[model samples]
Target: DIALAFPNQPRAAVGEVVTKAVERSAPTAQCTAVEVWLLAGGVLGMAEEVGAETKDEGPAKKKQKTTTDMTSARLRHIMLKFQDGAPKTPDGKKVRSKAEAETLMRKIMRDLNEEAKELKSKHRGRKPEDYALKSERFTKLCKEHSECPSAQKGGAMCGDLGWVSKDMQSKRGGNFRELVAALRPGDYSDIVTSMEGLHLLQRIA
Candidate 1:
């Protein structure tokens, strides 16, 4: 998050090499990713089609080309973090052990699964849109379980993650953007284990 806010610049390190320091103002490790961009340029492996505007060729031989139009999505998530030697949460508190964090994440997932089954049976003959599992259930659980600061807003509508380009996400870790892309709209992801924490992702779009 800090890296996104302060992109294209060198960042300070957070520590007490001098000793007796509390090591406040954690420096972002992500700042080094600029070096990768300087080398590979972007999301190296795949090609993303950027639509080009139609143009006229000769006089009456005007031609047109249309690439696939890109679209965006809305997403929300619940995260359970442990004190893994990383920094504290946005609220400036440390989490418990990893085992405890995983336990809580599983419990939340189980509850969500139950809700999905119930909703399925109850609305069998109705339109999918009317009964599809979506944000509300997850939002309720998120407030109670997620440690992410966005929890206060129930993960917020757009996740407050803003626009992330393929190039940007390539340098970022946690495989978060990839996992999120796999989910269907209105569907929640399985428990995701990453360096940051365990998470449940819900695609609102």
Candidate 2:
């Protein structure tokens, strides 16, 4: 409205595509609405003032309902175990500090993303080998930089713990399942620390 009010102004150039993420709910589906803050009385007599305090507080409870969302997930990780008495791989990476571990993990991530982009450009469609190629790339990175023995098989692709469940526990002892719960498929967490040292975990499946 401000820009339209001054039609002759040179500052009226606004051309951009913006994408917004909204909650998946009835209002989002049919109402196709977005909420905004209002002034004390009105904005140029646009409408009466409205705020979250006066909005319907009904569905807020529905969000807390329990579910049988227990499902198995697949994950691949590049572990950078610091030499601070954390669990060691067969060939312990002599990372001496959290900073060192994070640096290595970020390097691996950089390499992984570059290769992934190249692969997508090369096979730019829904090909049969899409998942295989992507996961294989992650596997290769796992093989290269990961301190875990799973790196031996390209980030534990064939390891016994293939599709892990929410209730499952790690033999090395950590809230591994909790970590899994924090991610959706194709999402990776920031550097997480436990007795297992610094981790860069991604849920591929």
Per TM-score, the best of the predicted structures is 1
Per-residue C-alpha lDDT of model 1 across residues 1-205, encoded as one tens digit per residue: 3222111111110111111132332553222222211111011101111222335532433222211122444556778877756676799876577656655665576566567656656666543334443435666887777777777763344233444444543444576666555444445554555666777665544
Q: What value does the lDDT take at residue 150 in candidate 2?
A: 70
- Indicate the residue-level lDDT of 166 in model 1: 49
TM-score of every model versus the real structure: 0.50, 0.48
Model 2: CA > 4 A from native: 1-70, 84-95, 123-137, 154-160, 169-179
Q: Write the per-residue lDDT of candidate 2 for residues 1-205, one digit (tens) a residue.
A: 4222211111111110001112334444543333322122111111122232335663332222111254877766778777645565569754366655655665565555455445545565533133433545567666666677776763336222367666553543465655556554444444455577766566656
In candidate 1, position 68 carries an lDDT of 16
lDDT of each: 0.47, 0.46
- Model 1, stretches more than 4 Å misplaced? 1-72, 85-94, 125-136, 154-172
